[model samples]
Target: MTDEPDDLSDQPPLVQALLLARYTLVIHSGMRAVSEGETWKLDFASQIAEIDAALQTAGIDTTKPMFAPVKW
Candidate 1:
């Protein structure tokens, strides 16, 4: 119970958007596939899609980070 809560709002808007996008991609493609059943997959995809749409509507860039390749 002592674990501190991690708040995304503490991050910049663009960074928050990018972090959400990264998490959505990973959960949709990786963990959910094995851990979730059929019904949950659709729900998860729908939710992720909504988040992505909202991020785009807010003008957050979705392009792959240029520095990611070099840094990784």
Candidate 2:
């Protein structure tokens, strides 16, 4: 079998949208717990909020913010 890779940039519109949504979610989640300090949490929360709006504007399903409240 050949080891050729598929070009995601040339994917179907629907497929591209799905991939974009997944990427946005992953990035937002990654930034949510960068530092353990409260200050970092606040910054991350703010960043997530902005990203959510931007993603929604770009037709992504960023309906929920990535900041999950601490259970402690």
Candidate 3:
């Protein structure tokens, strides 16, 4: 309903977990896409990798798949 949250601390635990899960899902999808797409997408892949790293730096556990791979 409101603008996207910039900080997850203010959100509830369930929200925080869900957001992290969503980010994980996006990262997974991007990875798969970059793998299948053309070389120019390397830039996009790098950005996705950065997001993935940031999520990890925040201590998000990415070992477990949260949402399924996005069917684009």
Candidate 4:
């Protein structure tokens, strides 16, 4: 119970959006046939689509360093 809470809001908007997308997929994983997450795939995909639109409107640059491809 001594663990500190991880707050998403404390992160930048792009970071928050990316984590939210991952979270949506993970939560919908139960309906999956693979990592692609079968039945719930479209649901999460659409949700992410909305998130993408919002991010675009917010003018967040996803190409920033925080979003660069990781080697590991």
Candidate 4 local lDDT, residue 53: 64
Q: What stretches of model 1 exceed 4 Å from their correct place? A: 1-18, 21-25, 28-43, 63-72
**TM-scores of all predicted structures:** 0.39, 0.33, 0.36, 0.39
Worst-scoring 10-residue span by lDDT in model 3 = 34-43
Clashes of each: 0, 0, 0, 0
Residue 63 miss distance in model 3 (angstroms): 25
Per-residue alpha-carbon lDDT of model 3 for 17-62, expressed as tens digits?
A: 6566556646555342334554432124455566556666776543
Residue-by-residue lDDT tens digits, candidate 4, 36-58: 55443334666656665676676
Off by over 4 Å in 2: 1-6, 33-72
* TM-score, structure 4 vs. true: 0.39
lDDT of 2 by residue, 1-72 (tens): 233533446556764555455545555653545445543322345555665566557665544322332235
Which pairs, if any, clash in model 4? none
lDDT scores for all predictions?
A: 0.52, 0.49, 0.52, 0.53
The residue pairs in collision within model 1 are none
The candidates, ranked best first by TM-score, are 1, 4, 3, 2
Better structure of 3 and 4 per TM-score: 4
Rank by lDDT (best first): 4, 1, 3, 2
RMSD of 2: 12.5
